[model samples]
Target: MDDLTAPTGREEALRAMPHPDGTAPRALVLGATGYLGGRLVPRLLGGGYSVRVLARDAQRVAAFDWGSRVDVVEGDATDEAAMGEAVRDVDVLYYLVHSMGAGKGFEAADRAAATTVAAAAAAASVGRIVYLGGLHPDGVPLSPHLRSRVEVGRILLDSGVPTLVLQAGVVIGSGSASFEMVRHLTEVLPYMPAPKWVRNRIQPIAVRDVLHYLLGAARVSADISQAVDIGGPDVLRYGQMMNGYALEAGLRQRAIAALPVLTPRLASHWVNLVTPIPRRVAMPLVESLQNECIVKDSAIDALIPPPEGGRTPYRTAVGLALRRAEVDEIETSWQDADVLGVPSDPLPNDPEWAGQVVFTDVRTAHTSASQESLWRVIQGIGGERGWYSNPLLWAIRGWMDKLVGGVGLRRGRRHRDRLLVGDAVDFWRVEAIEPGSLLRLRAEMRVPGKAWLELRARPDADGSRYDQRAVFFPLGLAGRLYWLAVLPFHGFIFAGMARSITAAAEAADAQAGTG
Candidate 1:
């Protein structure tokens, strides 16, 4: 092996030149909208790197707080021309793109994309290419997803670029795919008839620690270029990870009965039937669980030292992730990924169809309270503070949703009294919010139709007028039937909700007046 410090080909000039600031290196992140990539940008910026992100659609990351702080170039990595444009003049290129959940032929797609990215980086004279890949045991058949990850790393390394591959197991963090699987499985099932793969050893690392390693990768001596395995201090079975999550969530210890007869296909279907994860995404994850993913080398520790306090324990990581969820401080979510083959449209209220059946129940009420006071009560709608009206009915609805594999009410608001464009509120996601005027929530519960709840407040002659609307776009006869079935509840739930919000606002106004 040759020292990575000796630059070869086009990288010679790039390595010799210093950044304009003569401080930190310039980095370009490929998948800025992804769970890990989204989190990595902030850490890189905080580390004083001039960060640039390349995304297929820049709008996907427009809501990120650091969006304005970094340079964004919109392009797809699979396109040679786009890749060339995105990889230009960067000291380090982070390749975080993967095609795991994209249905059939994802492996080939990943290979093609990696080839294009590597060729473009080599052409653009990128000094180093940092890639994050999955850790799998050798001498065994690898799952399609993990195999694709490894292939991508190989492609980058063979491109004559100084590529540093960091292979990791399950990443524990809020809104991560693996962590969500553990969370949903533990929270929903008390007695799980799991497959034999549940006993496979896995070393899960905290997302915070992953970010630390990524930041450290930028400053590592250029003489090191090889694959490094990273993991937390503890190595536990997949089943134990679930048990640890349950403990952190304050749930009772679960009973796991390992059944050898259950295959990966059956396990995927079971996961689809129980958790919010769909069949497509769960299938690959279930398939990959059969391989042991524990770390075999500690070479990464020599390059990037561990966090000051130390590696986070599994239980502590779970608790921290849950705390972020409780406080509505999550920066990104698995739902943010467009790989689920679901609609990514932010607002579904387009009225372009001339002939379509749209059902809506709109109600309005006038209150003596000011707009500001009412807005406060409207934003604080879900979570521990149950729905303002018909608490029993809401609980029954949530229970029914849970029975049908929907998100239910367990995913409470990320904040107690604030709403953002992508924030999850119970079974609804906040679609839009205007400070003193409007808040719209889109339904995420399993339904035969698209639904939204829009609330608006405006200044009236005397005080303020509150308008509430429940809009549903039915799919077919089944959707119509579903709407008709829930029609009775709407009258009771929506009507009472309008009155409740008004009363609360009026009470607040009165209290303010007295004060």
Candidate 2:
């Protein structure tokens, strides 16, 4: 992913679409915390538009690097007072939110949110409303998910305010849910048994091109208030999409068996078992896949020119998506912005995981090792250095993770010496890092619930103190049972890990003194 704060040399060009008062037009993004909205906000800022975001959690928005750059109005869209005030001073509003994972009455929830935005935008006299909706066939009976999207688009257009709705199919990118789905399913299944929807044809768009068109839409005429389709050059069947990912990942082609009896519900459960996607999110996505979605015309080009050379082809997009994994760096992931009980949150030394049953195993060791040596060992915990514990157990765990389509331990670190907050270390994602003090790693392996490992080093009277803790939050009965199953291995894995790490630090410090 391109740096969100970098200037694209087109800031001055946006001056042509200036506000009525001769200022840089301010754009208010409704779903600023979402995947598409999070990406769009920084580009809007880079393109010379003053941006504001409506966020339910202001602190979450503030955590982003570009958070301080944009104005934040903390509120939900369904709240009438908040929506009215949020749209008041904005010239353009981007509606990138929908009720995808909301269980029952999701259609009602989406309709209500869209209705609120339409009314608020019209009442505030916002310049233009831009929305991103799914691309579906014309006269077919749409699924509840696709039907709700179409209804939301109609709500925006019927409002007195001019709206431009960009309809796109499966978006292909490093962190995109669709791309992740394709990647995991292809990697895990050599011989696939899929639902009949795997044969459906769809036009997948690259995330960069999606951003390009969204940025260009800001400059389009207010008269263009209709929904336009945007997508990549080549259209392929869903099975072909999976094979495309397999090709980019340098894996052999998969043999697919499309079974007619497998329903969307069953397919979602299968997806949950294989990929990181939760069943709720997968259900709607699977249902929508039943339709064949493709660009019917070249209408988007007349308003917004093709991205530089042209739109990315399907295979090329897959390659771009795979490049991040190859380098062990995914800027954002579907997990970061997906369904419930996501394990991305920090450990509960405080109240981060309050009211939940948190199981923990704590270990401490005092060693005749310099603080610097201890810090180095803690920082280099994963990757090629290994976990400083039983090799067979670690290997077995990694193999199990790979079998279930998890990232596994093969995705080493970005650097051998240094560490960053977002860097990937084997099957763990670096959650927090304090120089010479602390490192917290969140588990990315497929588990029933959330898990984290924390390591800390501090200066003692003569040497150093090393502290290690393993924390887990159970989801349900299954999550609790999983914790019990692994509890016995704590002696072999966690305790030995702590003792080995301290011993290694002592050895390193002794060697340094001799040198």
Identify the candidate with maximal lDDT: 2
* Candidate 2 Cα outliers beyond 4 Å, as residue runs: 1-16, 20-22, 80-85, 341-360, 367-455, 469-489, 500-515
Candidate 2: deviation at residue 7, Å?
13
The residue-by-residue lDDT of candidate 2 on 1-515, one tens digit each, is 44122235433344336657778888999877677887888778867789889977676677566889988887777889989888977888999888777778888988999999999999999999989999999999998999999999999999989889999999988767798789889999999999999999999998877887788888888788999999999899999999888888889999999999999888987886676565666888898899899999999989987866577888887887677666645555554442432235566565655777889999999988988899999998877889999988997888677565565675556456777665567778777888899998888777988899999999998898999999888889999999999899989999999899999999998898899
Displacement of residue 297 (Cα, Å) in model 1 is: 2.0
Would you list the C-alpha lDDT of every candidate in the order shown? Answer: 0.80, 0.82
Question: Per-residue alpha-carbon lDDT of model 1 for 1-515, expressed as tens digits?
Answer: 11111113212122223477686677999888777888878767755678888876664556677988888887777888877877777899999888856878888888999999989998998989999998889889998888999899999988888888999888888777788889989888889999999898999998877876776677667777788998888899999999999888999889998999988878877886666665566777898889888999888878877765677788888888888776667767665654533334554545653487888899899999999998988888888876788989998888677655566776566557766666677788777788789998888777897888999989997889999998888889999999999999998899999999999999999999999
TM-score of each: 0.81, 0.79
Candidate 1 residue 425 Cα shift, in angstroms, is 3.0
Candidate 2 clash pair list: none
Model 1: lDDT to the true structure: 0.80
Q: How much RMSD separates candidate 1 from the native structure?
A: 6.5
Number of the top-ranking candidate, with TM-score as the measure: 1
